[model samples]
Target: MWQNKFETRLELEPRPSRYLLIYQIVLHTLAGAALLLPLILPAGVAFVLLATAGGSLLWQVWRHYREGRGTTRLIWRTDGAWDYQIGVQYWPDLSLLPSTYITRGLIILHLQPVKGRRLYRVLLPDSLPKEQWHLLWLRLRYAGFSEEDVGVKG
Candidate 1:
């Protein structure tokens, strides 16, 4: 008989990616420009409007940056047991959730929030790995959840 050994450590590594840094820089530059546009405009009203828009964009950009920094850590194990820390913005009416896997080892799973009874918009990742998706499916099945409970849109 053959067996596999497992090691627990960060899977994606800790180094910052150049692509991600570049993207962040571009986003901040755009926000800065937006904030500056209002000041450059000739009229007060136009300046005020642009400034407000820029301020909102700047706030959004900063929030996005914080989230990226916070979620930089990824966890994985050689035995296939893995869990990634993920989060979504608040929705007034709806709640979003990601499905989880029960076992570990070379697994991919789809994580999505469950819809709330009330109406609210929830943004979810477009696609997750098929292996994780299947693991989530089996876990849900084992938990006695119906197919409807595991349905992911987006």
Candidate 2:
């Protein structure tokens, strides 16, 4: 017999995905190759291209590290509305989308916000204890999210 009641709050510390790391490596490698093109072109033109690529790579790395450093909190209320906080952003009155996206090591929750773009929160099960992850998964399903959306690996 499973209890219908669930914990009111859950705090998840997400980890960076290895796949994302690999993708970043590939992206930087391609950028590095592009940066070498300045050797064959005019010095001024090549400098601009090199600067642009270098800046883009630095920005991507900074964003990735920042995103992976915070704890995400989910707070559910009896009235059926939920609040999600990640880093400094707060989302209230969120509804779970009907589908969930699960991958090799990640479970993504697609949330519908009351007045903005849909939000996707990624969870790394490997970073959490199995029991805790299972509990969170149960609570999500209990809240009306479906597991039928589990095929895409993004």
Query: How much is 15 displaced in model 2, in angstroms?
Result: 4.2
By summed lDDT, the worst window of 10 consecutive residues in model 2 runs over 1-10
RMSD values for the candidates in order, in angstroms, are: 11.6, 5.2
TM-scores of the candidates in the order shown: 0.30, 0.60
Candidate 2 lDDT tens digits, 4-72: 344455555556555666677788778778767546688777778778877877887787677677766
Per-residue alpha-carbon lDDT of model 1 for 16-52, expressed as tens digits?
2344445556775676566565465567666676567
Error of 2 at 108 (Å): 2.6
**lDDT of prediction 1:** 0.40
Cα error of candidate 1 at position 47, Å: 0.6
* Candidate 2 global lDDT: 0.66
Q: What TM-score does model 1 achieve against the real structure?
A: 0.30
Which ranges in model 1 have alpha carbons more than 4 Å from their true place? 1-42, 72-121, 126-154
